[model samples]
Each structure stands twice: as C-alpha cells, then as structure tokens.
Target: MWENKIRCPCSRCSNNKFLCEDKVTEHILNRGFTGAYTIWSLHGEHDVGQSLRSRDRVEPYASNKEHEEYGEPIYDEEIENPYSRMVKDAMGPEVAFNYGCENESRLQRLYMSCKTAEYMTWHVQNQSDDGVLKHPIDGEEILSRLNSLPDLPFGTKCGDQKISGYGVSHNWVKNSILWDLPYWHMLFIRHNLDVMHIEHNVFENIFNTMMDVKGMTKDNLKARQDLKVSCKRPELELMKNNGKIFKLKAAYTLNKEEIKKICAWVKQMRFPDGFASNISRCINEIDYKFYRMKSHDCHIFLQRLLLIVFHDMVPHSIWDAITGISHFFRDLCTTEILVDHMEALQGKICETICKLEKIFPSGFFDSMEHLPIHLPYEAKFGGPIQYRWMYPFERFLQHLKKKVKNRASVEGSICEAYIIEEISSFSSWYFEPAMRTRLNRMPRNDDGGDVDSQGRLSIFIHFGRAFGPLEKSRFLDEDEFYAAELYVLMNSEEMLPYIKMFDEIIKGDVVHISEDELEKVRDARFVKWFKNYVATRMDEIDPRILEISHGPGRMIMSRPDTPLEPVTTVVVS
Candidate 1:
C-alpha cells in the first residue's frame, strides 16, 4: 500500500507532502486541485503537445459592455491611445480606486492584529538617540516636520473640488490614501527609490556628455548658449564662424580621435561567463556611440568598468570627478551596509557631486545626479539597495513578455501560460530529491561527472566545462609533458603524503638549506624521486599511486577557447 501511494495535489497539500490514495482523493474532493493541476504527469499522464490549430484558436465570449454590467473587468482590450487614456484616468477622482476594502477596514487590519500592532509602534522603540543618521527612522529634522504638520481632513481634494481659494493645501494637491493611517507619517523609510534606474540614468548623462555624442550629449549647442548667459567662461561661449553659430570644444568633452579610441577598446573586450552581457555588440564604430545597452549593462558600466575605460583618457579634473561618482555608487549598492558609515557617505557623495558641478556644464546635473544625495539616507534605514531595486521585477516582466504566444489575445495568452507555469511549479515540489528541477539545475561551467567516491586521486577531477570546438589533438614535447605531470601531482590531495615525505628527505640531505632554496630543490627533483619511491612500494599500494608514478601522457586535445571576460572591444573610426 505504501509503494502505491502518491502525494496529493489538493489546495491544502499543494504537492508538498505525500498522502495515501484514498486520503488524496478525499482531499481533492474537499479542497479542489492545487493551482488547478490539469497535467497529471505524476499519475502516468504525460503532457502531450496540443495541436497548433487548437493552441492558436481564440475563444471569444463577452463584450466590454457585458463585462461592465456583470461587475467583472476580467479581460481588458489593449488600449489604443494608452498615454492619453492613462493621463485621463490618473486625473479622475479616487472614489473608484478602492479595491480590497474601505479605509476603516484597512486601518483595523493594521491596528487589530497583534503581530501588526507591534510593527506600527516599532519606530518609537528603534529610533536612535545619537545625532548620527543610521536609518530614516533616526532622521531628526524629517521626523520633526512630519510630526509638526497638521493632517489633511479625510476626503480633502486639491483642485478637483477646491474648498478654499487656494488650488493646493500646503503644496499638497490631494491627501494620499496612506494618510488615513494614524501612523503613516511617523513611519521611517516612507518612500524608497529604485537604484537600478537611478544608476542607468546617471551613467547615461555622464557617458553621453564625455563622449560628446551628437544630440544626446549634455554639452550641446543650447547648453553652450546657456553657459554664455549663466557663467563667465569665455572659452565655452558660442562664436559666429562663417555666419553660422558654432560652439568651441569644451575641455571636458573628448575629441573625435579620443572617442574613436574608446569605442575601439570597448569592441575587442571579452568577459567571464555570467558576469555581463555581450557589450561589444552595443558599440557602433561608425557612429562612435553605444546603443541598446540594457539596465544591467549600465549597472556593470557604472559600478565596475566605467573608471577602467576612462582612467587617463579624459582630462585630469574630469576623470577625478568621474572616479569619485563611480566609487560612490559602487559603495552604495553593496549587499551588506554598515549603518555607522552612512553618515560619512552622505557627506562624501555631496562633495563628489559638487566636484562634478565644477567640471561639467549646468545641464549635466539632472535629477539622477541629485537623487544620489537622498539614497544614502534611504540606504541607512532601507538596508541594501538590492531589495528596493527593480532588476528582479524587470526580469520577471521580460519573462511574461516571452509567454505571449498569441499576440492578438496577449492578455489571454499570458493568463493561460501563467496558470500552466503555476501548475508545473506546484507539481515540481513532489519530484524526487535527485531529479533536476528549475531551482536545482546545473550551472553553465559544471563539467565534472560522477566519479568513484572511495579511493580516487583528486588530481583526476576536472572542473569548468570546455567551451568551443576541439581544433586538434597533438603530442606535447618532453619538457611540456613533464611540466603537466608535476603540476597535477603537486595539486593532488592523494600525493600530499608522498610530497611531504620527499620534503623531509630533502631537509635531511641539505641540513643548512634556507626555506626558498629548499622549496626550489623540492620542486626540481621531487617528481623523479617520488616516482622511484612509489615503484619501490609496488607490493601493497593503491592503483592511483601506481598511475601517478607512471606520470601523465604526452597526447592532449587542443581547443581555442577563452573566458567571456567582462569587457568591450573598440573599432577605430
């Protein structure tokens, strides 16, 4: 009876635990299927592929009017004028925006639950006494302002239905739904910024300006025009050349040859596996501009590679400022943050931006540059920037986009695909421990197959899967073959005892030898002496010892493969 039993796929069990056949049927009857398990792979039913005709077929039933009347907006058609509709919808009253419950119900959930009630008053206990800012909750000025401000009356509107002559109340247009909570304003870390996008924007501004890409650069014609009026820099002011207005080359912007050189360097670069994407493809040699760089690519550039590529190429002042900003971001995005250090970082970042302000034009300092000032404060309370970033959500959205098989009915297709994925995920929990699931899949570079666990030499173990095609097989020279054998034996765990024995014999032979000289003697003659020593122990020895004594073979397979290092190549224009 135990041999025939299987895990139940009911809502309660969710394929996580096993149950007897009778109990499983009873559970299913009582609780229904877990994530609607239609594919019964565990019950000897394979997932047969549906015909193309059936898969592509769009089954239509209800109209938009009928959906509205029935109090269901299950299926929404693709918005034709999405931007305009979005703006119009955003401007409408908030009375229709309520989804789960009324304001009273949400407040009750926050205050009534013993677990939640403790969290509501956590700030009062956790707030710091020292002047140093560790978390947002420790912020004195912000908290004082929040506490001082009078709460807006419930249902108060700004411009929609103005009670007084003023369009807004204390610069606030409308009362936020969150303000309904008594403790909303008092809570620390009320708003958090997405550092992923912030990094991308900051990198975009700096890269474009330094490279002086046409139209995209912050050091454009209009910027120079503004520079003339705003600042007293005579060199940067626009001059009328041959009846056409022309801007002089700024000291910060790179020349044509410098841009070409940078682009060429980025093109020929390679990266380690899984480190970053093919950034070389994004480089356009003809135009000398980077294109189609994703957020992660921007992240890689800002955090790691930005300074390396631009170290000595740009002017000294510009490079110094850029390095300061780069180091600031690299430190900010660290997984483990020290609270005591955030106060210093906050001041350092402000100084770094000021240095940038001195070098670059006025237009260079956009909201992205200014946003970093608040980030350290947020990071103080928010912890690591990874939790607040949009990288995971962006990847998940990309995954959802791949699920669009039927583009005509995209919503329907995503829904169906999502349901199927849920079913598979629920069923995967019951799979055997040894079986490969999504979470337990092998990494790209795992090439070591199963080996004898008992008495094998560690030197025979291979790691990092071979990449590219094998070009040819050839025999190594006498010296090359010996070198390989020595390397393997030196690194092998099984050969450690023999190596130590040889070392002791060496120490005895050269009584007055120094440490460095003794190491050289061991490296030079250890292999030959070890081989002869192993041969003497032929009567009772492991097979591995005999094999090592014979040494490695001359023949080896050659392949032209290099690590995809995190780098880019450049083509000279």
Candidate 2:
C-alpha cells in the first residue's frame, strides 16, 4: 500500500509533518510539491474558496494579471539564486497564496490560471530573446519577379495574344512580350527596380508606345525638330512702331473766311429771351475778335460774357447758350479776371437778395398809401416811424400837400410815407428791452437780432430811412421828388398796351392795357416831366460801349513860355 502523504519538514509545511519520510519524498518527486504548501494550507477552506472565486471573476477582465504576478519576480530570480531562502521568501508568499486560491477554485478559475501561465511563459521567452523574431516567406518573390518586365510595343503580341503598351488593348499584335496582361504588370515592374540599377532598355517599349513607333524606335524627334525651327522665325524678323494707329485725329479744319462766317452766324442769332443768347453771341464774338485783334482785353470780355451767361440763365437756355459760350471761351482765353469778378458779383447779389427777402415782410410794398417809403425802409423802420409823432405826421402832411398840388403825386407820396412808417415800426420793435434781452441770451454768433457792428447798424438805419420823409426843399423840382411815384403809375397804367410785345421779349406772361389808356396816364405833368428828365440823364446813367473801343485820350498841354533844351553835337573830322 502507498504510504499516507505527509507534509515536508520545511518551515512553511511544518503543520502537516506527520507522514512517513518516503511518502513525503515521493510527493516531492512525483507531484512537484514546493516547500510553501504548509503555510498555504493555514488559510481556512472558506477563505481560500472565496479568494479563488474572486480571482476567477477578476481574471477574465484583467489586462495584465500575468505581468502583475510573475514578470518582476522572474527578473529578480535571475539576479538571486532560485533555491536561496531570501529568493523563495520574496517569491514564495505571492506564489503560495496564488496556488491556495487556484486549488480551491472552479474549472473557470483553472482555465484563467493556465492562460496566465502560458502568457507569462511567452513574455519571459520574449524578454530572454531581446525582441527580434523571424518572419516566414511564401511565393511572394516569384510574383514580384514575374511583374518586373517592360511594356510591350504598340500593335505587338506575345506568342499568340495581344499586349497593352500605353493604353488598354483588345487584340494581340504579333511580336509583343506582354500579350493579354493588365496594365499593372508594367507599373509593378517599374516600381520594383532598384533606383541606381534601372536600365534604359527597361523603358524602351514604353518610349516606343508614346512615339507611336515600334521595334528599336526613336521617340519625340520630329516634335523636337519642329520646336527648334519655330524658335528661329522670331529672331529673324524686324519690328516696326505700331503706336500711330492709336492716336486721335483733328475734328475740323477752318480757314479765315469760314471762321468769320461762323462768327457772323452766331452774332445774328435772336434770343427774344432776354440777354442769354446775346451773352453767348458776345462770348463767341469776343473769341473771334481775340484771334483777329490778339488783344488781352478781347479775351477778358469773352470771359466776362461767359460768366454772365452761366450765372443767370435757366437750365433750358444755359445748356444751349451759356455752357456753349463757356466751352468756346475755355478754348480761346488763358486768363479770366472778368469771369472771377462776375462770379463774385453773382454770389454777392444772391446773398443780398436772400437777406432782403427775409427782412422785408410780405405785401410790404403792395400799398404804402399812408407813407411814401422804400420797401427796405419798411422792414427796418416801419415800427419806429409809427411810434414817432413827428415823422409820421410830417410824412402824412407831405403826402397831403403833394396830392393837393398834383392829384397824381398823392398815391406815390402816400406809398412812400406808409413805407417809412412800417420801417420805423420794425426798428422800434427790434430795439425793445424784452427783445434785446432775448437776443443777448442767444449764442454770440446766433441768428437772433444783436447788432454788433456800428457800421452795419448805420447801414441798417440807412436802408430803413431810404424812402422816409425828406425836406421838400431838397428836391431840384417837384418832378424830381415824384420820380418813383410816376414810375409806379406808368408801370400800372401806361405799359399795358405793349404787354404782349413785352411778354414776347421778356418770355413772361403779358397783361393787357390799351394804348389810349397809357397815353392818358402819361399826360400827367409829373409823369411827362420825369420822363424828359430821365431821357436827358440817360447818357450819364448808361455806359457807351463804342467809346471804349477807341483808345483813351492823352492830355497834351503846349508850354510855349518855357525854352526847349538844345541838342549837343560831337565833332568827328
């Protein structure tokens, strides 16, 4: 009979050391039992079983149990003797504990234990070999060598079948080496060659296919010859200037007669629309006159005409007359002082007109029957004259005296008086203490009425008093005093019959007045006398254009009383 098994006499197995020595020896020899079994058995069966169950659950999910269990200790075993107590002590605790757990566990636990052992053995072997492993070869090299051939020539066949060269082929050409082969055969062959060892012969069939030539063919030679000949033609030719083709030509040719005719045509043209056409004609005339006379004064006059036409005309006439004049003068004259002056005057006039429009109240001039004052004075002095007893009474009395002397003078004198009263009224209104306070509260340069300059105030006063009552004695004659009064009457009555003619000339609507009525109105003594006076002074008020055409006179006085200086002569023999 087999002796009952006994634990080994080592310190770890001492608790179960009751068996025969032969049985223990047999167990160590046959079962490969280690000295740590005794200590492993000290853990209770329930504890060991629970540990094994826990390990069985963990092993399937563990990534690195083998490395954790054996890897580091295995390396330590190489440094220390495997049989030494210090080595066993270090390795035994963990191994014995694992073995106890494994023995009590189920088959699933055993499988994981075996897998861990196998993986640990592999890791150890790899570590021992320093990581260089050999790979096996199959028939890959034969396939590679078979793919290392050049492309076949175009229209060539290998044995009985067609081969592709540059493109896919459906039929075989006789004498081709790569008949019925896919295009990949040539790609593989080219790609497999060593860079330094590749031969020109390898690409000979490809070159032949590209050239559409076969059997030891020359490639691209005809193309190269054509390119060389094309290059030589450019060097052999002479270049000419092509710039003259792009230049613009002159518009028209004009001789002296043609130019003079053009000038006359422009001058004779009628404008019936006031001075617009006349201004343009003058500009053109001045331009032609400049070319004929070569005078700076003619050019200056042309510039002035251009400014007048441009500044005054409406859109319809401006384009036809003014803009045309400006363009013509721009071509002729280099200097333009007259144009500058006209432009400045236009700006000043527009500004003055705007100021007048704002200052004067509407209907200010419609009926100044209570006073004979100018419209400007009505704005500036209307309030002051109404409040002042002396001025308004004097004005009313003057109007009455003028009316009694000549019934025609009544309307004009009363109108002037009314205008003066209104202007005086406006001045007194502006100068009131409340109004002055309001004006002072405004900003320094604000639009409120704060008269800063004494000169400007004087001008305002002058403007206000322009049509106010003056001493009757100051007039040269009663006709002179009633000049404006007669004008008002004539504009209202005598100018009516020629209304259509005036409208045609002025390009405005006409109001009808009979000729007989105009004659009757003109028969008034003051009207007749004023007309004669104006006629006599017309030359003084108007400039004579013809006089300026001649040279200005030089004053020469004879001084016969003084002796003239004698001429000295040098004697040359």
Candidate 3:
C-alpha cells in the first residue's frame, strides 16, 4: 500500500507524512521515534485488542525492541520502600501518599494515539488571535509567563527569591510534574480553577458575613479588630461594654428582623424537579442560618435566588453590590459563552468586585473573590463552565462512594460494583427504546411521556405532573372558576388563535379598546367565547382545544412536592 515508502514515525512528523526509508531513518535520528509507538501498528504490526469485560485474556507480549531501547522494567521487589514500610508498621497500615516524580515516558500518552494527539495540541493548532481572551492561550498573564519562561532551574531557590520591593516570589514552589514534558511550558492552560467550589466558597463567605453567623462568619471579632486597623468606618468599630467586646452592625449585614424575613422566605421556598436540591433543608428559621448546604445548594443560591431573597431586605448600596456579584456568577456559568460578551463580563466582574470590596469587610475579600476576575478570561478559552466545574466529578465520586459494599476492601468492592455498572450501561445500549434504560428513563415529574401524539393539541402534549401525595381537593367557586379558566386560556399557546379572534370581535364592538382594557376584557370574556369559537371550528380543530376551551375542571388537587412547606403543584382535573 505504501509502495515501499512508509510514514515517518518521528516525534515532529508523528507518522503524518509518507517518507522514503532513508528519509524516515534521517527523521528518526534527528527527532527520535514518536512517543509510545512501540506497537508499530501502521507498519504491518497487528494490535491485540483486550476487552474490558474479560479478565482471563492473555497479556500482550512486550516488544523486545522496547526492552532493548528502554531497558527492563523495575519490579517492586527491586525498589525498597523502607520509609513507607516503617510508617505502616508505626501507623497500623495507614495509606501513605505517593509523592513521586512524573514518569518521563508517560508524556507519550498524549501523543500515543492519533485519535487524541490532534486534540492534545488543539489550543495551539486552533488558536484565535483577534485580541479576544477566547482561550487559555489568550490569558495575558499566564500566556506571557509560559512563553517567556525564566532560564533558572525548575525548582531552584532563585525562582523563589524576593524582588526588590515586592514580597518574596511565590511563582514556583516546586517544579510541577508536568514540567517533565518538553512542550509543557508552551501550553496555555496548565490548570483550571474548579469554578464549582470557588463559587461555593464565595457564596459561603458572602452568606456567612451577611447573616452574621457566629463562628462561621468572616466578620468576627478578629475581622472587626482588623477593620479598626484597615478602615475608617466608626459605625463598625469595636466597642468595650463592661470589659466585653462588641462589634456594631456593618451597613452591608442584615439586622435581626431582616434576617428573619429572609429566613422565613427561604424556609417557605420551593423549587422544581431537577432544578436544585432541597434548599429549605439547610434553612434554620430559629437560628436564621443556613446549615448543611452543599456545593450545588450554594450554586443555586448564588446564581438564581440571591438577588430575589435579598431584594428590599438590605440597603440599596448593599443590595446593588450583592446583585452585581450574583449577576457576575450567573453570567459566568451559563451554558453558552460569547467572546464579545466575555470582554464586557471582564469589566462587569472587575466593577462587581470593586463594589463588593466597598461594602464587604477586608476579611470577605479572599482569594475566591479575586478568582472571579480571571474566570471570564478562563471561560473565554475553556468554553462553558459546566465542562470545567467539579459538579460532575463530585457527583461521580458520590456514586463511587455508594458502590463500596465491603468495608475491609473498599477499592475491591468499588471496582466490582463499577465493572457491573459499566456492563449494565453497555448492555443498555441494545435495549429497546420503550424499555427502561438509563438513557431513556423518565424523570419523576415526567408528564406521562409526550401524552399520545394523535388527537392532541400541542398545549395538551406538554404539561407538568404533580409528584407528591395529594394534600387537598376542592371544587372552584364562581369567582375562582372565572379566574382559573381565564388563566388557562390566556396561557395556552394552542388557544392564541382563538384569543386573537376574540380580540378582533371585541375591537369590532368597541371602537377604541385600549390594550390594557382589551387585555382585561379578553381575560373576562375569552374563556366563554373561546368555547363557542372552538365549537364553530370543532370540525377543523383538534378535540383537545375544545376540551381546554371549556376550561379545566373545578376540582383542584394541591400537592407539596418540595421540602419547603408550600403548595407548589396544582392539578386541575
């Protein structure tokens, strides 16, 4: 197939170009063989496939060429771990952390397979240079530092020395394991901040400081003491009351009554299915402190609920600052990121941080607060925050933790359960779509799966289902019936045409029907007129429209689906 000219397996060429035998030899001598290319699969060497499902398969033979070039592998028996053994003997078999150097050969793994090699250098290959901080490579600080690496030794003390006036240099504590790779310094994003935990930490700091939670809050006696040295705010200054120290309320913090109001609101709040965890579970109405809120809980609070809950409760300046920070996060973590918008976000985040700094005590401005300034830049390159966040990894860790059945052999039990799960997941691919598999499984609140396509209007095709046990059922009264029916007809997309027809009829009767009055009239008469209108077009319209036109049944079933003590789900029969 090659016509005696084989692909050059050099590090630079990476088996990408066909070269004569002499050229191939020359390239290999100049650039070394492509990393981990021992198999020679492209050069007529067959690769042995090993199924993850089977454990009895014979181990593939290691090439003698590899043995000749790299030397024999080091066995555990040859390398002694006296320190580890001594620790095990003293500590009763405690697990010792592995502090080992990065394997030089492992760098090959990134370029070993052609499938992944291209993606490994994607930032370099597909770099955008239109002055947008659209990728890790565009992060000015990191890009410049990485590109203009100092000539000093990787882990030398010289890299840690203090500059003339600036504090001691903390750039390189120790050489990173990644520095073993020749191209490590060239890569734009060597590490990513877990936005999940950063947001969670930032939220905790804000919530704790604002609520004035004892012990947990950043605004404690020490912070107040520091404030005495840091700021000129006399209201927040510490007071000596009969030898007992007291700190006055900062303008940013909620008073006891305000905290109570916010707590009561949260205590009675409810969320839809799959939106967020039970936030009310963490709310303490008595203490006015949220307890046991997880990362995801904080995520929901910071992004969706912070501004709503704090509205009108705090002073305007405080509220505006909180709103700015809250909005910064909401925009930062969205599913789609626009580069142009990200630049605007850069300014917004800086302004938000500045606003926060003006309101919050010095203690509140931790590294996490500073971290947001870099986030928009990271988002420009990294794309959506979801892919880089720890939510999925943390959830998977929880899943792995659940898999441990044997206390004595935690790893073994987890491995066994994991393999079984993988097998089941793999097997599910072949299962019929109608059958329940992980992929086709319905949510707890699924409204009975698409409702039969035939003889159904699009409005009826999609609707919510109440999941909790029914709490109450009552028939609607005259006023309730009028309001309920109007709400249904007004909201239904399928009923929009009938609503327009009714509007025209109203316009014909009343020469000047203002939009506001027309809306009111529509709300008053649309339900009854829609029924008669749908009746006239019953021959052409779907039967569902007629059913909805008559309005929902008076029997309303209210159910509390969430942890919050509120009636969230209403089913009108």
Candidate 4:
C-alpha cells in the first residue's frame, strides 16, 4: 500500500520508519528548497549529495553577480568536485539554507493530536451532569455562609483540607436553610468546586467571603475613617506635651528668674496628676542666688570659671549652679579692687609735678616744649593740676599747651625772651653733663673694645647740642632765621658737633617718627643746615672732594669755578 508520508531526518523525530528520501528530494526541487530541507539534509541525515544538487540549482537564480561569485553552496563539499564545478560554471552556486524543521514538525503533530482529543473529550464530558461542571453559588449565598461561621481560632491552619471540610458542611447548611430557594441546587455545586482546595484555599476563601459579606464599597470607606481617627488622637496629644516640655526647658536653660516665674505659673495651672506641684518643687530646690547679679559681668566670669573647672567634662546640668555663684562673687570683688588702685595712682601724679617745678624751673619748662600729648592727658587738661605730677619736666610744655592753652599767651614775649636765654644757658649745663655720662658709660678695653669708647665723649657732646633745646626754636620767625644762619655756618668744621646730633636723632627710634613726620623734617629749613654741616665736615676732615675735582677724566673739571656750567656729559668716557 502506498501510504502518505512526511519525513524529518532528525534523530528525535517521532516516526523513524515514515521517512522517505525520494519525497524529501522531490519536495526540495518542486517547492523550492526551504531552510528546512537544507538543515535536515545536512545536520539530520548528513545527506551531502542532496544538499549539493539544491545548492547548484538555486545559484543561477541568485539576485546579483557578487552573490553568484562567492555564494555558499547547498552542500559545501561540492566546491571540490569537477562535475559540481562545471555545473556551477554553467549555472551558479545554490543558496545554502537552514531552518528549525525538527522542532516545527514535532509541534505540529502535538497540536493536531491534542486539539482533536480535547474537542472529543469536552463534548463527551459536558453531556453528563457530574462529568464537568461550574460552581452555581452566587456571591450572596457565599457571603451568608461566611457571616454565619464563628470566628476561626487564631492558630488554626486554615489550609485547603480544612477549608474543603468546612465548604461541604457550609454548603449543606446553606441548602438546609434555603431549601425552598430557586438557586439552592446551583449554590450547592458552587460551594463544592469554587471554595474548596487541597492547599492554601482556606485563607483565600475566608478573605473573599468576608469581602462579599461586608460589601467592598462599605469596607473601604470604614477603613479610611478608622485610620483618620487613630492618627488624630496621637498627633494632638504629642503636640500638647511637646509644647509644655519646650516651654519648661527653654525657661530653665536661658533665665533663672524666668524659670521661677514659669514654675509658679505651672503650679497655679490645673495640670494632670501632680505634674505642676512636682515641677515647682524642683525649681525651688535649684540654686538661684546668682540670678540677682547683672547678666554681662556674671556671664563672663561664669564662662571663664567653667572653662577652668570643667574644661575636660562635657557640660551638663550638674555644674551650672556652682559656676554661676562663683562668677558673681569674682566679678564684684575684682572690679572694686581695680577702682581703688586707679584712684591711688591719680593722687601720686598730682604731687610729683609740684616738686619738679620747684627744683629746676627753667630746665624743666624748656624740656616740656617737645613732649607727646597722649589722649588721657588731653582729657585731664586744666580740669586738675594732676597731669603735672605724672609727666616729667620734659613733658611740661605738652601738659601746659594741652591743659592750659593760655600758658603760652600768659608767658608772652617775656616768656619767649626768657626761653631763648634759658635754652642757651641750659645748653652748656646739659651738654657737659651728658658728655660725662656718655664717657663714664662707654665700654673700656678691659671690658670689651676701645673702638666704641675712643671718641665717645666728643661724639655724644656734639650730639647733645644738636638735639637739646638749642635745636628747637621758640618762635616761627626765629626758627626760620636761625636755620638759614646755621646752614651757612655748618659748611665749616666748627659746626660739626651740631650735625652729629641731628644724625643721631634722625636714625633713632626714641622719637617714633613716622614717614609723614620725616617728610615734615625734610621740608624744615633745619634739614638744609644739617646737610650743609655734613658736607662741610666731610670736606674739612677728608679733603677728598678737592682730590676728586682734579682727578683724570673728571667731568666737573670742564666747568668754570665762578660761573659753573651745567655738565651735560655725566660720564667722562
């Protein structure tokens, strides 16, 4: 008998005996070789010959020349054979193709058999009432049964087996109660099939049944209301307690007086339990003696004492009372002592100046003209004679000018004349004494070196005259005239001592001269006198300027002595 056959060379194909090589080839050639034929021929049967024929036949129909030139053959082994090469030369290489034929074939058979069997069985089973069925219990009947059940024990397994037993009993009870109802038969079947399961069905049935009994719509609304009521009570209570605690702690930490007042307020308030009474008792026990002191000084002393005592401990409530009390006493005592010392120092200053005025009247007053007028002395001017006590004789002029502005006017021309006479007379007195002091203080060869002491007396005596009252002018006009005369006289060796004094004071820090002061010094006519003195002394002592004037290639030599020419060529070369 010639039977209809379909073949797949795959080893796992269900019907091995049904495969036909002839049919497979005819299918490839007629239907055009699909990927299935290529895959089955090569990988399933290892049938290289069939693949080559398909490859050769399909190549001539290639879409382009490049594909024909290097296209893969249906059976790759054919590339080496003469006949295959000739066939390819005459036509073209076939397209090699692969597809999942084995999987498709197996699935097609399975689907056809399963679908046929399902249809037959479905029809046969549906004809009988008990064969295949659906539950007939409506949502209302299931809800009624659930509501009737007593609440399950908390630890009950609620597994499917237990649920199945309950479901059967529940269905019987439902029918007995609703025997005359039209849907009783339907309800019985539904309770058996829909509600019972072998595992984990009890919890699901209970939940679903409860949902139906309550009605999902009402249950959701009730849940929302319950949550709101639960949340509000705790929130309001929390806020009320927090506000009371916040007020109590804030008053306690910041101001002791405020804390006492607040505690009294709490005691008057109608608080729950003994809360107000307890808080008031706690406040009374705390040490608040320091609270009577002023805040600023108390705070400073408290902070300092705390730093000394508890620098290593992290600060907490335990040390606050002790530190505050200590600070109050410390600030009050220290401030009183400071006030007493200041008063005593003021008294001493007033007595000293009176004695100084009597000892050397002219010498002391003349020294006062150049003293610094600081702010404290400025405020005390004329109000009291106390400044004269603190200031030395040299500072008397500053105190007079600042304190008694009329002192200069009071002394008048006679004072100026007297000052001029006194400055000149005092120069001799001050110069010899200063020179002797310098000489006596000088380092000797036995102590260190003779270099520092050799001309020490002469140098210092010269310096003393240049810096002493002689250098300070009594009036503006006199100062200008004296500076001009001094400049000219300074061009000679006789005036060298004054120049040395000017140099010493200019470089020294005793005067604390700023750049502005130096500029003022430079603008003063006395600077010209000092410069001329320096040049004149250098000329007399060294005689090097005369030598430089006659030196070879000297540019200055080109100028005339009387009417000197401006030497335009600065360098001789």
lDDT accuracy of residue 445 in candidate 2: 29
Q: Model 3, 1-573: lDDT tens per residue?
A: 288788899999998999898898899899999999876777655555556324423222334455567897433355444544534565675566878645543434444444345555554357665655444445454555655655422221212222242334654444557787655775556678889989999999998888888888888877777876888767777899899988887777788898888888887777765788778888876677889999999999998889887887788888888888888888887665678888899999898888887777777777888988998877776666776788898899999999888899999999999999999976766566578878668766556666745766655566554456877688878887777777776777777777788889999999988999998887777776777767787889866766776776878877876423344655666
What is candidate 4's local distance difference test score? 0.35
Q: Against the hidden true structure, what lDDT does model 3 obtain? A: 0.74
Prediction-by-prediction clash tally: 18, 31, 3, 6
How high a TM-score does candidate 2 get?
0.13
Q: All models: lDDT?
A: 0.74, 0.34, 0.74, 0.35
lDDT of 3 at 437: 76
Candidate 2: where are CA atoms >4 Å away? 1-242, 245-261, 264-573
TM-score of each: 0.55, 0.13, 0.60, 0.11
- Summarize candidate 4's per-residue lDDT along 1-573 as a digit string, tens digits: 126555534334422445465755555456554444433433234455867978968776763555567784544353365544535765666777786565324423322333333433442244323211122111234435555656533221112112224434435333346666545654422322110111112122212221222342122333333434544422212123745521112111224454344445533433222211222232332542222222222233333433243323323432343343333223322311232333443444334334323221122222221121121122121112222223244345654454333554655644665576567654434344345543245533122322434333221222110111212113224444444444444454544565567646675943777778764564464545555555666656434323322222311112211111111111121
What is the TM-score of candidate 4?
A: 0.11
lDDT of 1 at 493: 81
List residue ranges in candidate 1 displaced over 4 A. 1-176, 447-462, 472-558, 562-573
What are the per-residue Cα lDDT tens digits for candidate 1 across 1-573?
A: 247677788998988777897898799899999896776666545554677435535433445556768887655665354445545675786555545785335544554434345565554456565644445444443566556665423221221221333334454434468887665666566777899989999999999888887778898877777886777778878899789998888887888888888888878877787788888899987788899999999999888888887887877778888888899899887765676777789999999999988877786777888999999888776666776689999999999999999989999999999999999876665566577877467866666574656666775544434456666667778887777777877898887888888888888988888989978887789888987777788877688778777866666775456444322211111
| Residue-level lDDT for 446 in candidate 3 | 53
Alpha-carbon RMSD to native, per candidate: 19.2, 49.0, 19.1, 49.0
